[model samples]
Target: MKILSAFLMLLLPALVFGAEQTLVLDVSGHCGSCKKRIEKTVKAVDGTSSADWNKRTKKLTVSFDDEKTNKDAIVNAVLKVGHDADGKTADNEAYSNLPDCCQYRDE
Candidate 1:
């Protein structure tokens, strides 16, 4: 019984401190400023641990705590900041409002 109790104690932390989830999603933008914007937008979401945007790949890789936020939430946040994510496009007004240098697709 004592041995079983010790094993459960060792396993408890793992259950409580769940592993961080990593998700990579397509995000559209151009230039260094775009990279900064996308990453910053994702990181602003509650529970997001980190965000990386690749200019060449146009992929946004984010690490976040699933318990507090999900992929959809992160994607929406990115969209709100005027970036395209997955199949969701940014709000037209917001997209159009981005600085000329940050625009990825022509209007």
Candidate 2:
């Protein structure tokens, strides 16, 4: 009984939260503002639990519930905000809309 209880406790969180996926993508950006924008955009995606961006590395790490969202959705969200992810090109209009300092394409 004790063993069963322990097993259930370990399994309960996974069952309740659903399967989670973590992906690290090469995201383009240049500064602190870009990090904030990238993190905010990724986190706003449905099922995404958390997002962290490292400006120096230009990497965005995101965690989401796999049952609710997928990689394309997360990537699109970032692109929608004028940030390119995993080699995908961002929309021209959206990219142009970003502040001059936030643009990374030229760099």
Candidate 3:
């Protein structure tokens, strides 16, 4: 039992550390202000290590600790801030409320 417990302990860190992931989500945005808003929203989420958006690619790449927050939570954060995430859409009111220069699509 002691040997099994030791073995499990050794593997626990590996399992936990391996949960950190960097993912790119298709996020819609138009310009620099959009970039700032998108990145800020992602970084506000707990466990996010870094967040960046590319205006050309319209992709938001985020690195986060999965133990603290998952992809869906991150995506939802972006959506709440008026950007369309990979599998989620921004609320109509929120999207419409964004600055005109930040709108990426015509609604």
Candidate 4:
């Protein structure tokens, strides 16, 4: 019984801490400022652990805690900051507010 109890205790932490999820999603933008903005917005989400945006690939790779947030929440946050992610478009006003050089629409 004691051995079983110890084994369960060891396993509990793994289960509780393994809710980290990683996703790579298509993100639209056109410059270094865009990269900074996308990554900063994603990292600001409640449970996001990290964010990386690649200028060449237009992909944002992020790691977040699923228990406190989800992909949709992160994507919405990105959209709010004027970047489109995972097939969702940013609000018109938000997109319009982005710097001229950061706009990807004309390209």
Q: Which candidate is the best by TM-score?
A: 4
Per-residue lDDT over 78-102 for candidate 2, one digit per residue giving the tens place of the 0 to 100 score: 8998998899999999999999999
Q: Report every candidate's CA lDDT.
A: 0.90, 0.91, 0.90, 0.92
Q: Identify the leading candidate in terms of lDDT.
A: 4
lDDT of 1 by residue, 20-48 (tens): 89999999999999998888888899999
Candidate 4: worst-modelled 10 consecutive residues by lDDT: 11-20
Q: Give the residue spans of candidate 2 off by over 4 A.
A: 1-17
The alpha-carbon deviation from the true structure for residue 103 of candidate 2, after best TM-score superposition, in angstroms, is: 1.2
Residue-level lDDT of model 4, residues 1-107, one tens digit each, is 99999999999987887488999999999999999899888998999999999999999999988888998999999999888889999998999999999988877
Instruction: Report the lDDT of model 1 for residue 29.
Output: 90
Q: After superposition, how far is residue 46 of candidate 1 from its true place, in Å?
A: 0.7
| Model 1 regions lying over 4 Å from their true place | 1-3
TM-score ranking, best first: 4, 1, 2, 3
What C-alpha lDDT, on a 0 to 100 scale, does residue 68 get in candidate 3? 91
Error of 4 at 66 (Å): 0.5
Residue 90's lDDT in candidate 4? 93
TM-score of each: 0.90, 0.86, 0.83, 0.91
